[model samples]
Target: MKVLGMLYGMAVGDALGMPSELWSREKVKSYFGDITEFLDGPKENDVACNFTKGQFTDDTTQALLILDSLIENDFIPSEKLIAEKLIEWAVRTDAFENNILGPSSKAALLAIKEGENADILTRKALTNGAAMRIAPIGALFSTAQNKELSEYVFEVSRATHTSDVSIGGAAMIAYAVSASIEDKSWEQIIEGALNIYELASKKGAETFTASIPERLKLGIEFADLYQDDEETFTQKIYDVIGCGTMTSESVPAALAIAYYAKDPNRCALICANIGGDTDTIGAMATAICGAKYGYDAIRKDWIDTIDSENSVDLKNYAHFIELHKPQFKGV
Candidate 1:
């Protein structure tokens, strides 16, 4: 149930935040007035305008690509399989034509289509594209298997985003989810994520991007400082931590907001309204939230809506994950 909870939570968050993606925090507030329910994307926001209510954006789609690849590979993370799955999804969904794909992923996949090596092509591609679709990596690896987890993350994420910040942010989210699946409290998950971030950061090629670990620390501080002022917490996270496409900003913002919300549903709500890259942030954060709380914590109506509205069967993904989980290569 918990394994499925992680997937459902990611989908829920993605849909919850779909309409608000790419909008600034101020614009989100001015236009939507803090998202409480799923709404269709308005014509004003170019990135989100095409999506309808209860529809998840590319974040969830890409996450499922990873899961599908893993399930087919007997739960082993294969870079080649991941790349192939991504290309298939992009073409099938018209991701490139629709402008739904993230910038870094689009560039890398395009290079791959031209027979260029994705590893080299993604050398400087630093964005949350890797982190946004990384929930499965967390659920696949255990907290103690940091070495294996980092290797798997690098292999999968480097196909699209190769920078230290990008890979590390993806690992950070995965590590937090691993901790959550182990029933760790949000505090423990935060600590575990930071520790793994340093290890994972050293694996990828260094880039000019800001350090995800350092920004994550600041996010924690921001979370603490805003405890007495819950009303301004989202705004503070938006300004200081940011909710941008950069791996450094969105991943840490997701982690901090997840910790602050302390519940899957609340995490979805708070992140949905946080503006810039909201769907990615929400997907990442809420997945971690669900790992801790499991199925019972989520509302039944939300589950039914996500099942009916989305294309993928979240339960089938979860079932496959659970069935093959014993064969996970992370350990």
Candidate 2:
């Protein structure tokens, strides 16, 4: 139930946030998108967003593919096979074109084109690329008895993000999800994530503090632009973070949503509505919620919003989880 929730919840949240992902508050306003609730869109420049209500984007699609690979290959994904599968899946499903890939992922794919080792390609292209699709790693390893779960998470994260910060960010999300499955409190989960970030920071993660004031101001400004000062809390972290491509910007923003939003759907919706990197933020929040609540707890209406009623295999995913349980024997 926990694994099912994390996977499916991420898909649901990713789909919900797909349309408004790249839209600015202004652009959203032009589309009668004042309300933050999930809405349908077939807007231009938003290919995946046009994927009908309940249809997931690359976040969920790539994540499930990774999960499938891990299950089939005994938790050690072969880089070549992984790349081939991703390309085939992208072409067959039409989720992405050649130009739509993230920088890190694209770099790794290019390495594959040049016949480089998959592991080498992954380790060299440290980016948020890997972080976006790691929810299942959290779910599958939820029962890790020793600290081996963290090490295992680092291994998976290093496939695409070897930098301490990126791996740390991935580990934070992975363990947060795992802890959620164990029914850990929100505070505990946040602290766990903080611990990972602190570890990475101490080990020389790059600092983006110069832009933090601007980002904090920007965050607060945006919140005020939409929500009155009394209703938003963006000002509190003004000195601590900034918004940018770095893990510091991305991860903390996602955690902020999980920390503040009072409910599962609410958390995902808030992250999506806030705009920048919505899918990733929404994915993270959904992962945490799914870990905490399990699959059945997610609202049925949200599940129904998924793009396919007849397709997508939750049961097979469940089977994968069952098969991997024995690997935890020694742990």
TM-score of each: 0.96, 0.80
**Tens digit per residue, CA lDDT, model 2, 17-125:** 7676655544544764543555665456354444555666677777777776776777775655567666667567543453345666666655565666555555444
On TM-score, the candidate that comes out on top is 1
Location of the lowest summed lDDT over 10 successive residues in candidate 1? 322-331
TM-score of structure candidate 1: 0.96
> For residues 157-233, could you state the per-residue lDDT of candidate 1 as single tens digits?
87788788888889999998889999987788999999988898888888887777787888888788887676688
- Model 1 misplaced regions, further than 4 Å: none
Task: Return the clash pairs for model 1, or none.
Answer: none
Look at candidate 2 and tell me the lDDT of residue 283: 82
Candidate 1 local distance difference test against the native: 0.86
